[model samples]
Target: MFDRHKSTPAFTRFTYFTFTYFTHFVRSAMTAFTLIILTFIIASIFHGLTGIGVTLIATTALASSYPMSHVLVLTVIPCLLINLVVFLDGGRIVYYLKKYWLLVLTSFVGSFIGTKLVFIIASHHLLIALGLLIVGYVAMQFVAMSVGKNFKLPNTTPSLVISGTIAGVLGGATNAMSPLLVMYLLSATEYTDDPKTELIKASNLCYVVGKIAQLIVL
Candidate 1:
């Protein structure tokens, strides 16, 4: 007995609701995109001044808008992947394997120990304190150009072992270890007035490997 020509109001209302939902979703996505761009710009400014600043800067920015634990978890894998790519593509791996196999091996062993330590630490404040101290010391060194004069490094096997072990311990305590690693390397070398290009490259290699190993262990 119903009229065959009658339009169904339910179908028309559903179509209108779906369209409205999609429109709102698109607007929200655009807003998020804008926010991320702003964060990247701020991070980039830090990176320009110091190579190690980007991660901290970006992490801070993300933490401002997201949960700290969530941001830390999200950043780990991508940072690891990026370091892997740079280590491989930049010939750093080949350089270390060819010229500094022992350094690489010792660092690997140390990194394993460090990774275990990270699990033992209940609070993250120690790591933050260490990171701040490292950055501060480096900044002071940069301000005083003559500070590295007469820096003599231990150049024996036993010394290398001890250095690696201590570096490993610090690395375990903090997510960062490059500052300690570099200082140890410099102390062992008599690099005054000589081109230290190779030494610089080797230090970078250590950092790359240490970071990658941390990523794996953590």
Candidate 2:
């Protein structure tokens, strides 16, 4: 009677198991939380030093442990804010928009479609594809440097639309469009007056729209 009133054997064992599970859960949560904090801190530092890496770094780091969809959702807001700061601070917005409105619109469409595909396709396949894409980009860059080839991007309307659409799809799927954007901008023969500013303005415009689409979709 006294044992029953105090605690039955089954109840005591269950209580112990629950406590142990809760403790493990808290520890795991804290560890993940700390890792996220450090990752973003480093990502932001790199972004400040260079003009890129906020979303790329954060997404790559977090996606290693989390689901791609969750990683995308987590980084969207921060990426949006960062892109907005770069874009708004760059100024000459009207001229840039006038020159690149088609690119921007195409990017929006591509990003929306790509983001929607995140739900349609299995994320692990996308993750593997993303890995391959990054590797391919790096390899291409290395080859270009080895061959001393300056890739000249065609400034035709088709090229502009195609580049923007591709960049947007990649950005929506992986959130690492900075490299393509940089490559696209650097290859341009025009915009030599203030290439850095123009590049930042153009890339961030696409980034802003892409993030907005992500927000809308997810």
Clashing pairs in 1: 153-187, 153-188
Model 2, range 122-180, lDDT digits (tens) per residue? 88987887787778778888888999984556777777788888888888888867666
Clashing pairs in 2: none
Instruction: Assess every candidate by TM-score.
Output: 0.56, 0.90
Total clashes, candidate 1?
Answer: 2
Query: Model 2, stretches more than 4 Å misplaced?
Result: 1-6, 147-152
Candidate 2: TM-score?
0.90
Q: Could you tell me which 10 consecutive residues in candidate 2 have the lowest summed lDDT?
A: 182-191
Residue 172, model 1: lDDT of 42
lDDT per model vs. reference? 0.56, 0.81
Task: Output the lDDT of residue 132, model 1.
Answer: 76
Residue ranges of candidate 1 with Cα displaced over 4 Å: 1-95, 128-132, 139-152, 187-195
